[model samples]
Target: MRGRLLALLIAIELPIGCVTVLTAATAYRTIMGDIEASQVQTTDDFAVRMRVWYRGALRSLLSFGATVSEAALPPELCGQAGLKMLDRARGFSAVLVRSADGRLCSAALDPGIDAQVLERTAASMRASPPVAPWKGVDLGAARYGQASIGDRRYLAVHAQNPAATGQDMQEALLLVAPAVLESVLDLGRGSKGMDIALVAPDGGIVANRGDTPPEAWLPRESRPPAELDRWHAADREGTERTYAARTIAEPGFYVIATFNDPHERDALIQLAVFLLAPLATLSLLCLVYLRAIDRHCVRWLRSIETAARSRSSSKRARAAMADDMPSDIRSVAEAFNAMVDEQEVRQRRLQTALDDNRFLVRELHHRVKNSLQVVQSYIGLSKRDYQDEARTALADAECRVHVLSAAYRFTLADGEMQPVRVDLFLEDVVSMIANLIRRRDQWISSRIETAATLSVDRIIPLGFLVADVASRVLRSTPGARITLSVVDLDEATIEVALEADREVAHQEPPRLFAGLLAQIEAVQSGPAEGRSLGRWRVRHHG
Candidate 1:
C-alpha cells in the first residue's frame, strides 16, 4: 500500500519538476531577445539625433563655401581669403588652403605651430592623399594638437574643395586639422554622460568623446558578444548593448550606433516563465499525492474485494468493503478532477489573451505607418513656400521628419531593430538625399559623394550638414568648384574642409554664419571658427 502511495506522489511531482525547468529556460530566452530588440531601437534613436547636430554644423560651413566661391579672387583678395579662413577656425584646430600644385594659399595655425614646420607640413599636404597617416609621407615630426600643439609630432589630415567637375581641374581648396579633434566633435561629445568614440578594427580608439579624458574612457578592447562568434558590438558602461555599423559614404571608413535597453522579447519570456513555474510545481505535488493515495487506499480496497469474494456473502462482506476502501482515494480523485477543470478554464483565458495581443500588435504596426506618412506630408507642405535661407531651414526640417519616419518604418518591418548595420542606414539616407537634391534643383548642379558612408548615428547630422553646406555654397558661389571630402586624418580622427572663392561676397555680411560656426564649436566641444570678406576682387571693370 505504501509503495503504491509513494508511486502516486512521484507521479504528481514529475509535472512540477518539468514545469520549473521549462519555465526557467523559456524565461531566459525571452528576456535575452527583449534586451537585443530594445538595444536596437535605442541605438537608432541616438543615430537620428547625432545626424541632426552634424547637419547643423555642415550647413554652417556650406554657407561659407557658397559665399567664398561666388567672389572672384584677385591677388589682393587672397590675403582676405586667408584671413577669413583663419577667423573661422573655431571648430577647426588649424585651417590652411593650398593650390592644386601644392603652393600654400592662406593659413591660420593654432598656437605653437612652427611656421617652418607648417611650411614643411604644407609641402606634404600638397602630396596625393596618404593611404594612412603612419604610412604616408611624413610632414616631418611635429606636435599633434591634442598632445601639445608644439610638444607632440603629429600628421595632418587633409580635405579639399575642387572646382565643379569639368570646370577647373587645376584649382583646389585645401584644409587640414588634427584627426582626433574632428573625430571627437563628430561624435557629439559635449553632451554630458554620453560617451561617443571611434574604435579601430584592431581595438584602438581613434578619438574619445569630447570632454572626457582619454584615460577615463574604456579601452576599445574587452568588449562584447561572447557567444555571438564575431558580431559587431555596442555597449553602455559595461552592460550589454545593441549596435549597428555602416561604412562611411567616404571611402575606407566605418560608423556605428549603439544602445542598451530591454527588448519586447525579454518581456515575453518573463511572462512565460512566470505562469509556467507555479503550474508545474502544483502538477508535481498532485502527482505525488495521487501515487500515495493509490498505494494506501486503492490497493487496500482491491485486497478487501478479493478476500470478500472468497468468503460467504452477507452484511459482513459489505462491512469488509467499507472498512478496507480508503476514503482518501475518493478525496484525491475529487481534487484531481477539480484541478483539471481549473486548468481548462485557465487555458481558455490564455488563448483569449494571446488573440488580443496578436490583434494589438497588428494595430500598432498600422498606426505607426500612418503616423510616419502624416509627418512626411506635413513637412512637404511646409517646404513648399520657402526660399533662400528659409528654404534651407525648411529642407532640414523635412529631412529630419523623413528620418523619423524611416526609423518607425524600419522597426515595423523588423518587429524591432537589432544589430543595426550603420552602413545600410547611411546608404538609404544618402540615396534619399541625393534623390531629393537632384529632383529639387534643375538649375544648380549638385553632386553627392555617396561613396563616403558614416554610421547612421553620425550620418544623421553629417549627411544633412554636408548637403546643406553644398547647397549653400552652390547658391552663394555661382561659378566655383565645391569639393566635399571625408577622410581619416589619423588613426583616431576624421576631418572635412570647404574651400571657395576669396572674392565671393554675401548679400548679408555673414555675421550670422560666423555666430553659427561659433555655436557649432561650442556644442561640439571642439575648435571651430569662420570669416567673410567685405568685398570681392574684380577684373577692374572700367
Candidate 2:
C-alpha cells in the first residue's frame, strides 16, 4: 500500500516537476540575457564618453595647427608662438612645428623636449599624408601615433596645412597630456578585476591600467570590430568577461573596457532555488492530500460498500452508519435512500395506471368497432332498392365507414398508443378502393408511391382525402388506373399527388373536406392537356 501511494504521488508530480525544471531553465536564460545586455550598455556608454574626450582634443589641436600655418612665421620666431599656444591649451603637454625638409622649427615641452621623438615625428610626417581626425574617414590626412620620450610614453597627433600655399610645407605636432587618456581609462578601474586600454592603429597598447596587461587581456585579432561596438570573451584565466570597443575619431585607434560579470553566479543560485522550491512544496501537498483522502473519503466509501453488500434488513443499521459518515457523504446516503423509497412508490402507482389504461383502450376499441359496424349496416340498409347511381353513392359512403373501421383495427393492432405508418395506411386504403370498384369486365388498378409515416390522427384524415378523390376518379372514368404519391418536402412538411389515366375535371372538395383542405397550406391541380398533365397536388402544412 505504501509503495502504491508513493507511485501515485510520483505519477502526479512528474509532469509538474518537468514544468518546474523548464521554467527554471527559461528564467535562468532570461536573467542571464538581461545581465549581458546591461553590461554591454554600461560599456558602450563608457566608450562614448572616451570618444568625446579624444575627439575634442584632436579638434583643438587641428584648429591651433591651422592658426600657426596662416601666421607664416619664420623658424626663429616659431618657438615663441609655440610657448604662447601651450599656455592657452589646457591638456597639451608639448607643441612643436616641423618643416617638410625634416627640420624641427619650433618646440614647447613642459617636461623638456626629447630629440629622438622630434626626428621620428619628422620622418613619419614625410612618409604619410595627414589622417582626418573625424570618424568614418580612411587614415590619410590626420594621424595619431605613439612616441617614447625618454622613459615615459606619449601619444602624438600630427596635422598639416594643405591650405598653406606659400614658402615651406609646414606641419604642427601636438603631444597630448597623458592625464587626458588616463582620466578616460580610470572610469572602469573602480570596479574589481576591471581593465581599460587604448589601442593604436598597429595593435600597440597606447595606454592601459589594471593588473592584466592590455595585450594579454585582448589580442588584436580578438578585439571587437568597429561596427559591433561591444562583445564578450574569456581571458587567460578562463573567466568570462564582457568587452566594449569604440573607434577613436583619430585614425585606427580604439578604446576598449573589460570587466568580470557577477550576475552569472547569482543567476545559478536563483535557478537552483527556483527548480527545487516548487518540488518541495508539491511533495508536502501530495502527502497532505493522501492523508486527507484516506481519512475522510476512502474509509467512508469502503464502509458504505460493505454495508450495502451485507443487506441489513433494518433501516436503523443503515441510518446509524450514515450518521457516522462525513456530512457530505451522509447527505449522499440520505438522497440515495430517499430516491429508492420514491421509486418504490412510483412503481406501485405506475402499475395501477397501466391496468386502468389497458381497460380504457379495450373499451375504446370495442365501442369504435361497434359504432363503425352500425354505420356500415345503416348504409347497407339505406342502399337497398336504390338505383345504380344512388346505390353507387351509398356504396361510397359504406366504403368510407369501412375505412374508419380498418383504421381503428390497425390502431388497436399495435399494443397501445402508437403512431400509424402513413405509407402502409395509405396502401391499405388504396387497396380497399381498388377492390371495392374492381370488376371482371373493367379492371381498376392503383399504385402508391411514398416514403412517409404519420400518426393515426394525421393519417386518418389523409386517408379520407385519398379515398374520396380515388372514388370520384373511378366513378368519372371507368377502367381508369390511378396513382397515389406522398413526398417529404422537408422535416416539417409533405406533398401528396394523385394522378389518373384520363383527364380529371376540376371540382371543389365537398364541405366536409373543405376544412381538411384549409388545414393544408397549398393545393395545385394540372389539367390533362399538353405538358399540363392531369394531377391533383396537396401540400401539408408544417
Writing each residue's lDDT as its tens digit, candidate 2 over 1-542 gives 44577688899899999999999999999998897776666666665766676556666665665555556676666667777777777667776665444445555555457545565765674565444445544322556767666777677777665544454445666787676677766654346666777777766777777778775677335543564366667765565667777666435666677766566788999999999999999989988988877777777766666656544553323422444578887776677667656765787799999989888987887798789989988988888879688888888888888778777767767556555666677777877776665444443344455555555566677677777777766776666666676666566556666766556554655797756554433354544442222344443333
Quote model 2's TM-score.
Answer: 0.47
lDDT of 1 by residue, 1-542 (tens): 65665667677666766777677767777676666554444334443443343333333334333444444344247446755665665444433433433343344445565335555555554454322222234322221111224554332343344543321112222333445244534544224333444333333344444455534434344442221112344233444433444322122223344432233445655666676667766767666666766666666566555544644544223213234446774554445446555765787899999888877875785686688678768867877887667765666556656665554454445553322232344345545554444333322222223232333233334444444554455456555543333333344344444334344443442355444333323122222223222111111101
lDDT of 1: 0.44
Model 1 regions lying over 4 Å from their true place: 1-90, 99-103, 107-109, 114-157, 161-196, 199-204, 209-243, 257-279, 288-296, 299-542
- The per-prediction CA RMSD against the true structure, in angstroms, equals 58.8, 15.0
Cα displacement (Å) at residue 232, model 1: 5.9
Which of the numbered candidates is closest to the native, going by highest lDDT? Answer: 2
Give me the overall lDDT of model 2: 0.66
- Angstrom error at residue 249, model 1: 3.5
| Cα distance off (Å), candidate 2, residue 500 | 99
